[model samples]
Target: MHDLLRDSPSSSPRGSPYGPGDWAELEEVARAGNFDVLRSVTYNRVWITGQSYCRNRASIDSCERHLQSLWYVYYQCARHVSHESFEQDRWVLDIIRTRGRGPLTRPAPGGGIDIARTPEGTVWNDLPFLATDMTEYWINSCAEMDSKQRINAASFLAKLASTRIANDRLCQIALDLFRDTFESERPLGSSNEADDENEDRHRTIHGLTIASLLPSACAWIREAGHNIILLSDASWNDCSHSTIGTGGFTFVQSELGQRAPGGFSPWRWLYWLKRLHQIAEEASKADEKLLAEQAANAIDIMLSDVKERNSQILRVFEGAGDAVTQDKDFMGLKRKW
Candidate 1:
């Protein structure tokens, strides 16, 4: 392990300092349910790679492959690792909690505020990269797992989503993976019957797993948005109209536009509604009755909320005329709300 951690290059034909045999040994340890090994590898990898140690493409590729191999091991050992232990691990929580720079305040001479120079933050600042990688890995793992194992994966996601640090970025990671998986099609190829059969099975499981996770992602959005609103004392109108922008509403608009083929549109709400219905149907098919019911209820609530907001917007436009409506950015407000 110490030799692998050294900066010197090894004689491996692949050009990575640590070759296939090293990773295979690590994978064996992971398969034995050794969480300590996982923790050590994660910490060392983040420390080395996240600090800009990968100066070239080969090094970067090696780092990425190392991370990917860790995820494959994680999937194999997930059932053996206790969920309670994983959830309560401070390192895991730190991975979630540490986002950007910590707040810094310094007083200037003569009792005036000065431009505070940013101090060097901790390695945890790069933790979001790990968090995102974990999310992608979890999504891919769902494609290979059985129903019960997939449920376990979802449970892990729920724990992450429930954290205060879980926000639109995490949700977007899952959404991006889902979009890719859903849009992927089999290549036109010669005969490979067994491989095609495996691909089909994986695709089916992937879709179902993603569908089950959407509601959790939605819940994270709502919770994060509510917190933002409370912190800023910003109304929905302020969200839409303010030039500075609110975090939550800005995320929604940005995501909506990204998903839209022609860019941002008023009808993006319909796209989201379709996703909610898809979640409900998929969950029902997976025999996740509670999840299906929750998704169905969320659909009803979102529809009611949109209807009420639209009516209110219409009434305001009627009484205040076109000028006021335009000035207030009522169209943007309607689209967001």
Candidate 2:
């Protein structure tokens, strides 16, 4: 079942390079009646508390728009990550010039068709859900990209928040997840490693991850500034103290860590976090006191960015692909979002 969810453009590093052996493990998992893996494979997104849509356009309708838009925006953000992963997967495979003796399959440039473009039931199985299947695909496809491409791609995902998303909270989360993806896990049961060596490894990977996530964080905050002002002016009188934006600030600080003076590398990760803090601080200075619902809308945007980033990173780490699939029980067995 999880294997079913794993199939996507990102699932193949260079293309849909699956052979007979590729499906062997998945078939065994299926035969063992472990369909429950499906649930565990699902990604997390913050669901709106309200069940039904609000009808009143004045206050309630606005809230509905905010919530719905946030969800859609998050979906779009996920799509961006997935699209980037698919592209990177193909790019990495295309440029791969392996000289050693290996049975690695390679795809011609643009020869491998995207599942999105291929007819269903022909090249693959049923199309999986966009949110989970495709997102996981991005994660798996990360292995296909070389280190340089991975770094650049990760940074690109971080920067996504700035372009149209402009949601700082979301961007910060993306960075965090990306940072986490680069880390190698110690054997689950064993914890004996040289401290210096471990520290060096963390610093090296963390630096790259931080560098990737920060610029995007700054971009997200900068882009959202105008929206914050506009929303503030639009909801001057009716704004409640619990607006989504207010909650978003709290969420950002809590999830991404606060921006204190002289903490960690500002150029990589901490700098963007500081920028996010500054954006939130500026939002607080609006002319009118923000309504709880109104603020919540802004908060939703931020949270969604974080969620999207996290999703992308998860896809990069735990999703399918030849590179990440080297040790199924090692990297593949880990429970990622």
Candidate 3:
């Protein structure tokens, strides 16, 4: 499964090739991923507390949107981490690269396929629900660009937010089970554990995960100001107390860390994350190709050794059958009890 998920064009190191065996592994990864989604949505309980969503508008329609974002966003975020490429996924990579370029149809320079402004089967329409702090992000990154271009980028991002992209099937299935599992509406488990415990645990884990995504992104925000943006949902779930903007299924920390100086523009913070992902997209360029090839070779060697050893063990077992025929439990047949 890891192999299949890691084999995406953006994830694969540039110029590093995969053979038949590698492709076979990718197939297995896809198969396993599908099953994982099925099991996760099917068996998992409502992930977020309704009280959290209700504080704003417990009304039926708003609650439904919250539920949609919870399951859909969480699944997408998890994929970004588990599948590597910082879990940005393929469609996002395209948008980041060609965002303001308009509906691109020309081939990418290195034979990479061009991603249209609004690709079919994408989450382009769902951008508004993404809830990332992009208003500030636009200003920081496009400070020099004209307003029209900034608007274009913003539109692109909004589209990206709304589309389910890779999450269509999972969302469809999870939606079917929503009413039964929403934390507020969900039936109590065998043990009626308090919701406080669940919320606390999620908060702690989420904070750590978002914090960890930063160091990698610092590499890309070189020209951007010293603003701290909590990208995507990093600041989600925690946004109840903060004044922030979220869109395109991403989050940026609008407020400063406890010890840090005051917060900067939201756009400034998020620009860093976007830049960081762009850098990652190019990580597999020529410089890393040699290492990737070596890794591939090493895997083949290990597999070959394992195959030979298994055959040798089978041979030993098969030959042992004849020796068994000449012996008894503890002695030759003549001396057996």
Candidate 4:
């Protein structure tokens, strides 16, 4: 999806450290979702990338704003879901109402011209990162989700944060927020009449959900072209408890962390999925000791799945010989989460 990045990121946003051409290319590619034909961008990665590009079009608050959006997408794939039960839901909606409502070009009423809106009736931004199609995709997809599914979505979101250990303040904030909002011991906030929806203990519910399932969610996103890297969440001792609190463990034979063969298997995801459900039930009990134990068990499951997936990835380049570089990045991640 980021083939543009495979080379360089052009036309990202005004005042961006990246060249205009590089960020622009990313915008076009994401908006098109391909190079050969036209298609709307689908997930949080592309959608938020575009949103940040336009919001900071003026270069005011550019660096911080742009970086923040990038980290959000790097951490979460989808925008706020339909179930905005927690304060996080309200924050997400505030963004969606403004940034997710229309294309980057859509004009404001009464000839109001802004970075995101103009008198010409809202033509695509210079970056064209945000589009109605992507917004619609989010809305339509989220609309079908019920409370149960949303709980699962919450868990998936946590895993996204856990996998990639971004060394940034925003990433830390997101991780902390996820942990706080999901902890079951924290009683649900009282309902506010002004709020859209009132659900008791929204964060606790989502937090519990987050503790269960990792490998399956990682597999699903990977197959969809979203690669979740493995990093030790506990690497930064500044943080609270270990990633074990999330019930996602990293236990596997690393030698297989190399490349993969041809045609990977989706069927293997079923095994991880079943295990995720089991862990989810355990997480719901809110027993710290039990969750930690399950996390250790989950490590075994994750290790097995990661080994096979990595093997499959490397297999694809088997016939390429020594044409590739010797860089660590070129070899991809040496460890699995």
Best by TM-score: 1
What lDDT tens digits, residue by residue, belong to model 3 across residues 109-181? 5876443222222222332223332323322333222222222333233233334333222121111111111
Q: In model 3, where do residues sit more than 4 Å from their true spots?
A: 1-32, 35-88, 91-126, 132-262, 265-337
| Per-residue lDDT over 1-337 for candidate 1, one digit per residue giving the tens place of the 0 to 100 score | 4444333222222344556776666656655656665665655544444332223223243445544444444444442344446433444354454344332223444775332121222233332233455555555555554433444444444444445353323333333332432222222121222332232334543244444344434442343323222221212221112321212232245433343332112323333444556656776776767666766675665545545445332343345445534543234233443
Scored by CA lDDT, what does every candidate get?
0.41, 0.29, 0.27, 0.32
TM-scores for candidates 1 onward, in order: 0.44, 0.22, 0.22, 0.26
lDDT by residue (tens digit), candidate 4, 12-129: 4233354556445544453342422111222333344455555434332343334333323321223222223453343333333443345543233467654443321232222122
- Screening candidate 1 with a backbone cut-off below 3 angstroms (N, C-alpha, C), the clashing residue pairs are none
* RMSD per model, one decimal: 11.9, 22.9, 27.2, 17.5
Per-residue lDDT tens digits for candidate 2, residues 1-337, read 3333463322321112234443444335433434233222211111111111111112222223322322332222332333335542332221121111122122334786222112111111211121222233334434333333343444344343333222222233333332332122211111111231121322332233322323332333333433322322232212111221122223334323332211112212322333333333433453222322233343445435434444332333344455434542223224444
User: Could you tell me which 10 consecutive residues in candidate 4 have the lowest summed lDDT?
Assistant: 247-256
Ranking by lDDT: 1, 4, 2, 3
lDDT, model 4, position 66: 42
Q: List runs of model 1 lying over 4 Å from the truth.
A: 1-16, 20-28, 44-91, 96-124, 128-132, 135-140, 148-168, 177-270, 273-291, 294-337
Q: Report the number of the highest-lDDT candidate.
A: 1
